[model samples]
Target: MENAPLPSKPHYAILDGLRGVAAVLVVIFHLFEAHATSHLDQIINHGYLAVDFFFLLSGFVIGYAYDDRWQKMSIGEFFKRRLVRLQPMVVMGMIVGAAFFYFQASKLFPMIAEVPVWKMLLVMLIGFTLLPLPPSLDIRGWQEMHPLDGPGWSLFFEYVANILYALFVRKFSNTALAVLVFLSACFLIHLTITGPNGDVIGGWSLTPEQLHVGFARVLYPFFAGLLLCRTIKLTRVNNAFLYCSLLILAVFAMPRIGGADRLWLNGLYESFSIIFVFPLIVFLGASGAVKSNFSARVCKFFGDISYPIYITHYPLIYTYTAWVQDNKIPIREAFPVALLVLASSVALAYACLKLYDEPVRRWLQKKLGPAKVYQKA
Candidate 1:
């Protein structure tokens, strides 16, 4: 059973739902993060790791879906399929970000409204292509590659991983891939241990240092996940989804293990969690089955909306963060508003999914050619 060949097009239903679960946690974590002064005391301290988990999951899914199909699928076709599945949401996220930009302005961005409409629109235009603009083009104070939409940074890195996979990584032997994972793991460890913040946090900006962080953060888990899918030996596990979900929450919600004084300890924990825990969680998720129709539907709904919610919700978060900053409201007092923001983000994501992303993707697939066999979400 451990070495079983997967069904031709098996759906990793539990993995999909768990991806949604992590996305939701990321929103919660970001909401609470606005209130914290530092990582040491930040609520949902490790939620940043969700991005890494996503990378890992992506690698695993890509390997599972396309590794053997390379015999028939052109690299160009692989790129096209990915663009169809991912680019629609990327465009929507940018549009949402730009539309909400003015609402997010406050003392933090006092000149936001005064900035020329053409400049903002220019940023949004660049955003649609998923390209990172230089700092000179950064209208927002954060120096993000996509100032209009901060999450665009991750998508940029995601594309880098995809290109590497298509052109180079797909050809590696098992030993070579193991070595790649090891080297990436080393870089990750060094980064975590020496990072000024003692965590894997700063990757959104376009600066050289930030790009280094981004690449370092992505390389391991993505490749590791690819390797995991190739070598995974599944086993029976009862209540796998519930257990794995809890495991993920525990890692993300766990307080920073070592304070700033013992930075190595924190670094070790972060590295170990990514290098070991995340892949294990993904494996458990893949092995699990959705045993009930209710569970099946729940998984499908979350899976369907997960990417939409992730890409689009950040604009709403920017608004909420701005409000919290403007009012100087503490999280305790702003609790009700925080709840509203969370609920609204979910509602907005679902709306975008049905109203925009799904339709655009369907149109894209139709125009591009028949869709590939991989699952969309």
Candidate 2:
């Protein structure tokens, strides 16, 4: 289906809602983890894998969003829409992350003490995707914002995948095979070439040997989503059941992520986040239905805030956790506080999307002109 005709758009409230579900899952998961320790968070700890869920959603949405011009899209317009849609909030997220860390630097990241303030600022700016760099080819400043830290890594890949779709996606024969080959080469290469802890696995450093090798591995998951997006269709009973089942599976898988016993889950989430979760989500999402249940609203709302929630929850987790540690708050109070953090984050995200994201996206679109129609290759 990766090479098939593009699917229809709209009435995909379900897909968008699922995106919301992934967002809220991450938020709630973080909220639970930030406070009282829980076997629930760990056992169901696989909720963090919701990012992979987003990747698959992204691929399909990109496919659906640009179905008409998939074969003829200009890199400029494709990127313009993406930048318009994603940047303002992303930049805001970076600023928020940086400001929060700066205000509490003494408590937030001890690593900043080693690097000069200028260097840290550079990292923050590089990580932020809102800004564009010069054409000199020497600035090395394309590093989208890591303000919320690690999750920002996915945004860069999403941009690349989307652009690649615009430019080269039409010509690839057996795109699924191409994706698998890409995933395999990356994983095998990383396993063979790296130290016990090479650069491709973690986020503390993006330019180290690890990042050089790690980026390859991420493609597997991201493209897996793209592939799923191409193929997925929804039914009433079976599809809804499947999505619910996958959520159940992830819940069960979560506990397998925490503590001394969770080495593989932790490693997988860190190293092959895409490989691990993309297939599961794609399978479920493609097959899942948008049922008329109350939970559906939760899915839509969180999916809406998933972006903001994803960006905002971390600071709240770190800051709230620190306060809990310092004050020795009981599990009960910490749990409630975590819930409040999520509620507040969602409210903030609503404002961010409604006020900042919507307007900025329109303004950018007007300046960039319309998306070019297909002249299929």
Please identify model 2 stretches exceeding 4 Å from their true place: 1-8, 35-43, 106-127, 130-150, 175-182, 185-201, 209-217, 231-253, 257-280, 288-299, 327-330, 371-377
Error (Å) of candidate 1 at residue 9 is: 0.8
Model 1 vs. true fold: TM: 0.96
lDDT of each: 0.87, 0.55
Report the Cα lDDT for residue 318, model 1.
86
Instruction: Kindly list the per-residue Cα lDDT of model 2 for residues 275-328, writing each as its tens digit.
Output: 544555455554556666765675566456768767655666656655766567
| Native RMSD of candidate 2 (Å) | 6.6
- List, residue by residue over 1-377, the lDDT tens digit for candidate 1: 21222235877989989888998999999999889878899889999899999999999999988898776778877888889889988989999999999887788777686778899999999999998898889887788899888888998999999999999999999899999999999999999988876788878988999999999989999999999989989887767789888999999998987887887788889899999999999999888899999989888887887798889889888888888888889999999999998999899899988988878878876777766456842
Q: List the lowest-lDDT window of 10 residues for candidate 2.
A: 133-142
